[model samples]
Target chain A: MRELQLSLNQTQKVRLQRALEKLESLSSKANSNASVTVADSIPVNYEDGLLKGHGTSEFNGEVVATVCGIVERVNKLVYVRALRARYKPEVGDIIVGRVIEVAPKRWRVEINYSHDAVLMLSSMNLPDGIQRRRTALDELNMRSIFEENDVICAEVRGFQHDGLHLQARSQKYGKLGRGQLLTVPPYLVKRRKQHFHHLENYGIDLIIGCNGFIWVGEHVQVTDDMVVDQVNKSEQDDAKPDENSISPEDQGKNYTRQETRENICRAANAIRVLSTLGFNITVEVITETVDLSTSINVAIHEMLGSEFYVLVAEKESVRRSMTKKK
Target chain B: MEYVSPEGLRLDGRRPMEMRQIRAEIGVVAKAAGSALFEMGNTKVIAAVYGPREVQNRSQQLNDSALVRCEYTMANFSTGDRMRKPKGDRRSTEISLVIRQTMEACIMTHLMPRSQIDIFVQVLQADGGTRSACINAASLALADAGIPMRDLVTSCSAGYLNSTPLLDLNYIEDSAGGADVTLGILPKLDKVTLLQMDAKLSVETFENVMQLAIEGCKAVATYIREVLLENTKQLEYRRGI
Candidate 1:
């Protein structure tokens, strides 16, 4: 009963249990009892010149685990990969976070890590797309760019003396809006080559943050129009009489259709079910779950029902077994 | 009152050195990084651990180690007689301090520098030996949170009454005005991190009682290890390759 949060009938319960058992059998063959609890000794040959890594310590000339996790060995180095813990950031990883503080020249973001990540004003590309230095006026207007409590997407720049640093250089990395943010265990979100996915069919954007903060939002065409807008504004300042026409994109900014909202909900619920089942979350699996619900004609809200959960479980079992066969 | 019968059985039908049944469940709190509910007979405690994250108070952040904070509370309905208790009472403050110090001894604080870890344990049922139950629950929560520790710390209580040494004292025995010893130990390292006794006892008798408590702790440690290992495997296998 790993996830007993849902209420299921006897038949559904049996089916789900059987599916989970199959998953257990499938995974156990690959990593048979590689787990170690606190203080359990990890067997390592002394002739290899062992180098201990995180989550390990030496006790009485024996390497013992300091956490409950799977023992991972690479060459002569031994380490434990902990699950169900806070995000441990690495450089060049894409992450989603919420701004917690607006400091003098930086915004502190809560990225599900041990420390709040700092996004300095200078590290980000300003709206004008100019390469000028950050002036005092820009410092005063930092709130206009990203104020407190704004959900942001950024990259792990590096570690600073005080805390982790984040950068938002690309237009794809910025304020995320009109969507849902789902928090799962960070381990479930494996780092990938492309974290941003725009499902062309659903007209929705799915961002899989490395910190396990998943954003499901309506797809907005990636644009750097703010720089163009700034240039046009300065030009139009002197010729204000001829600035009557507005771009079609500016007029359609907040007009998300109701159907698109439903699509967003459907996709978000799909993610919810998969995360609850502890399945590996990739774009492919998420889209497949959504498609299953749609094909079965399950309502968006009913996707969380007991029957749908059982169906998802059975489907996952079939999917994994097929992959294993290949 | 004869606490131990002629048959060498306590009031609850357990032998002098026998402990009460223990049960543990992990991930009881959805929002916490780690959570566990542990029960020792009628004494039930729930523990939640948060962070190894940024310290809430900037001034209190440690430069080279994580700051460990603990708060212990007892619900009004947990006891037989419901009584309104003030927050931060003297007894609870003392117990919190004891639990914090015992936990800090085993946690590898230096690994998470400039962060703070918060441990909150509440008594759901207060039969007796609440201190020992709280310690065991906190240890499980810490392990579930994936926080590094030197060793798992397990605690148990032993008492001397009716000219016999008893393990895991009940409320009646605990309030009997006898010598009650609460011991916490790192079972793997064979090191004692905490020991507290209220009443007086002879040297030989104290040694015997302490030994009984340590044995109880080791038993509890074995149970906890089994629970953690099972939970870890479940998580691993569920998130399959």
Candidate 2:
């Protein structure tokens, strides 16, 4: 007949009525201590014999939440009584959050999970191109692509000892450039993550978060429409090359894989910027191995090989205008 | 004199001894094992029941029974002044104990020995009669959990103010009362499993107030019993071949 064996057992329940009768005699003597002053909280009779051995106990049968009563936050630290548990985060949860900081090559997203998510520029794949490096010019335009407060789509790339990394490499990811950013209570946001709206149509892409920072925006790219065309085409292909189709040089062991991946990485970040910026141009930066920097002119001219040719022509025109004085 | 002045009326303008409007629904939280929402006047309570899970502590594992636990919390804005923290309070703790104490008498604990059952009640608002509302709400949650119970437990506070005895006391009357009595009853058995009274009253008046409180609880139990019965009927209908 026994179901839950808490403090009020059969004896207790039956005894409660009798206890009340007895307690009546002591009522005048008992004091609620209304005159107590404010102070820090102190634990009172929260733990009975049952919950006392929690940390040391190896048994799974011990009921964790068996407390029936506790002290209130009284004048002086309410003699405390605790039985509740704390909440912790898990993996693969979608949370919405906001951008709080714009760091070099990374954005700090406050996802309300007590931790910031790093949306690194490297997470995004550059548009498909022969140019494998970003020049100085690209760095100047980087902030323009993802400003301090701009929201963006990203995936939980991986968590390292450093922090949680979010990536915008996929077509589904990147600068959620404009929108009314709504901040919701963290818990409500957690509850809403499971029922988030699909952004594919609003051309909206969401970060669906665990920390809560979210990005929503339409697509744009800075590279020429041709490069944008190639990036879109390459992404749509989603092609995984056959191992058999691998080049003989790459097939060999110790093929210096690390350097190639890093080289391609630079190009990838550049593509992320250009493709999102509405550039349809194909890669001309392949010839000169320029690195991305804060300077946009050097970045654009060096990466777009054709741009260098345009620069040369413009320089010759300037020279003719200067020598015509002779 | 009225428990509430005849001219002043109860906060909602009901006569003394009148219970506040109670709106209850079950199975509201999708993720909880069992959930129910009970709104007594404006004292809204949400309860979730989880149980029969493996008990993890070594010493608490009794060779013979499941454990019952209850946590009662009021949301910060539920009252006139905001509460900085939500959990771990004395009045809340006392209320929690009573809820646990009352529920233990009804649940069939032997069915799952060495296990535990948890009842978490969150008060979203307060006007008065919080304990009874929590009890009523927890009962629905337990029932929604498909747990076995001896009977539904309903609680309500009855008090005496001025000369009139009130059946359900709101915050104002309760604070201003000469005596406040809260009782939880097992309606079918006409048993009082949990009872607490503050302040004082004469013997005859105390008896009358207790009777009125029990009667109010019985009425609430009857209404909630019907709700559980209808719910079971619907569930059975869904599973019918």
State which candidate has the highest lDDT. Answer: 1
For model 1, residues A208-300, the per-residue Cα lDDT tens digits are 999999999999888776756877777657556645665455446767899999999999999998888878899999999999999999999
CAPRI rating of model 1: medium
Model 1, residue B25: distance off in Å is 0.3
Which sections of candidate 2 miss by over 4 Å? A1-326, B1-3, B6-11
- Specify the highest-DockQ model's number: 1
On the 0 to 100 scale, the lDDT of residue B194 in model 1 is: 95
Tens-digit lDDT track of model 2 for B1-241 = 2445658466568877678877788667745656789887878999998765545565786557778889998888889997687467688888889899999987768655666788999889888888989999998788666554556678999998877788888888778857999998877556888888998789999999999998898788767755654443322211110
Instruction: Give the alpha-carbon lDDT of every model.
Output: 0.93, 0.56
lDDT of 2 by residue, A1-326 (tens): 00111233454455433432332223223334211111111233434322332111111332221211123444333332211111124544544445778777767875543246787655555444233455555555567656665565555666776567776555444555433343321221233334233332223323334342333322233355444677666643553465446545335522434434333333433333332211221222211222332234454324433333333223323333344446
Model 1: residues >4 Å from true position, as ranges?
Answer: A226-251
The true-versus-predicted C-alpha distance at residue B73 of model 2, in Å, is 0.7
Candidate 1 lDDT over residue span B103-220, tens digit each: 9999999989999999999999999999999999999999999999999999999999999999999999999988999999999899999999999999999999999999999999
* Predicted complex 2: DockQ: 0.01
CAPRI quality of model 2: incorrect
DockQ of each: 0.76, 0.01
